[model samples]
Target: MKILRAEEEEALSEALRVLSEGGLVGFPTETFYGLGADPFNPAAIERLYEVKRRRRDKPVLLLLGDREEVGRLVEEIPPVAELLMEHFWPGPLTIVFRARTDIPPWLTAETGTVALRVSSHPLARDLPRLFRGPVTGTSANLSEEPPARTAEEVAHYFPEIDLILDGGPCPGEKPSTLVSVVSERVELLRPGAVPWEKIEKLLKSFS
Candidate 1:
């Protein structure tokens, strides 16, 4: 495992290289340090599950570079999801959508849905954009443990990580609010950085 400053000229390329080859990279997100794996690489995802001690039954969420990338994941964006993405994307909100049939079941834990977010963290957002694909956004820590707030914490948790882009300490706040727009009833899977009351108000605006 190696720690590289996030601003280092080679950090982005190195991360892309590791991810492309189905290796893991530890990077900072708006809320915490997360493990970056090629969302398209099932083998890498399996490794991620093992590294984090995360259960395979719980689907992993993905981080996107931007709002437009949603097309690559979902078949149709619900009207509510559209509005939420307009207001909350590139921030701390993860919206769940009915994934494209072609998306491997392993990625979604056979749930047939995928959770995605566009992070506001500069380095975090750039990683996926440069990778040209979604990156696993699961926090870098053993499952059921507090999420790691610093790159060092991530390294300590998993010493075998391929690369770690240290973006310094994260906000260390509540994680992104997770809501599902897969059906007419918008469901709140996790209440977090984006308040549910605020989102409920937005849902009311849906005409």
Candidate 2:
């Protein structure tokens, strides 16, 4: 396992290289360190699941650099989703949307929806932009294990990963709030960093 300073140009370059070759790269998000892989590459996604012992039926979230990246993966961003993105994105809110028909089933767990977030962390945001594609944003730890908050923690949990981008400790220890907008209505799946009341308040304004 190679541990590199995430702030270094060399480390960023290596991360892009490893991800391009369908390898696992452990990097930090605002909430926790995550196992990053090319979401579009089936092999990479498979490797991610193997590394974390993640369940096959569970889908991984996609981390993006900007809202424009959503066009590549989703069919359309509902108005509610757009409002949420404008207010809560680049922070700790993950929105699930109907995916484009061509997206790999593995990404959606056959549910035909993709969870996406525009990460606020510099490393999380910059890496996807540098990769020119989305990357898996699942926590870097074995299934049922505590999420990694630092590079050292990531190494302790996943030493066999191709690279660890050490960006110091994650700002928040909790996961992002997950909301699904599948049936023209917003559904709260999991509430973590963002409060459900806040989301509801925002949505209520549209009513």
Candidate 3:
């Protein structure tokens, strides 16, 4: 087990290196520790599912640096979704969009929509940027296990992970709000760190 300083570029590089080589790396996010692997790599995604004992029907979130990166992964970025992105990105908000042809089934869980988030946590944001492509951003724990709040917790849950980037405890003991943006409006699927009232306000402002 190894703990990488979140701010250090070497740590990010090392994690990315392992991911590029199809290895799993557990890292911190604003919501919880996430087990990361190359989003485009089907084998790596499968390995991630194996590590977490994740359900094939449940989809994984794709973390990116900014809107442009998000745009690249999805089929279309609706105007309302853009407004939400402008306010809530680099934070705990996930917008689900239709997947592009390039997105893998492992990512969307055989669904046409892909879940995406631009995290606020520096290391969480940096890890995805380092990869320069999306990495699977599901919580680091076995299926039905509590989501890990610290890297040590992640290590305990996923002992076989190639590397564990311990970035201390997450900001809050909660997950990101998830919304589907494929229709004329944004629909909240899961209530999380970002409350439904706040999302509703954002939608009203955009409308």
User: Which ten contiguous residues of candidate 3 have the minimum total lDDT?
Assistant: 1-10
Question: Can you write out model 3's per-residue Cα lDDT over 143-204, one digit (the tens) per residue?
Answer: 98889998878888878878888788886566899999889488889899999999898777
TM-score of 3: 0.95
**Model 1 agreement with the true structure over 1-207: per-residue lDDT tens digits:** 888999999989999999999999999998889899998888999999999988889999999999899998998898788888898888989989999999999899999999999999998899899988899998888999989999889988999989999999998889889899889468999999999999888878775
- On the 0 to 100 scale, the lDDT of residue 137 in model 2 is 91
lDDT, candidate 2, equals 0.90
Kindly indicate the candidate among 2 and 3 with the higher lDDT: 2
Q: Tell me the alpha-carbon RMSD of every candidate.
A: 1.0, 1.0, 1.4
Clashing pairs in 1: none
Q: Kindly report which residue pairs in candidate 2 clash with one another.
A: none
Query: Distance from true position, residue 152, model 2, in Å?
Result: 0.9
Evaluated at residue 184, the lDDT of candidate 1 is 47
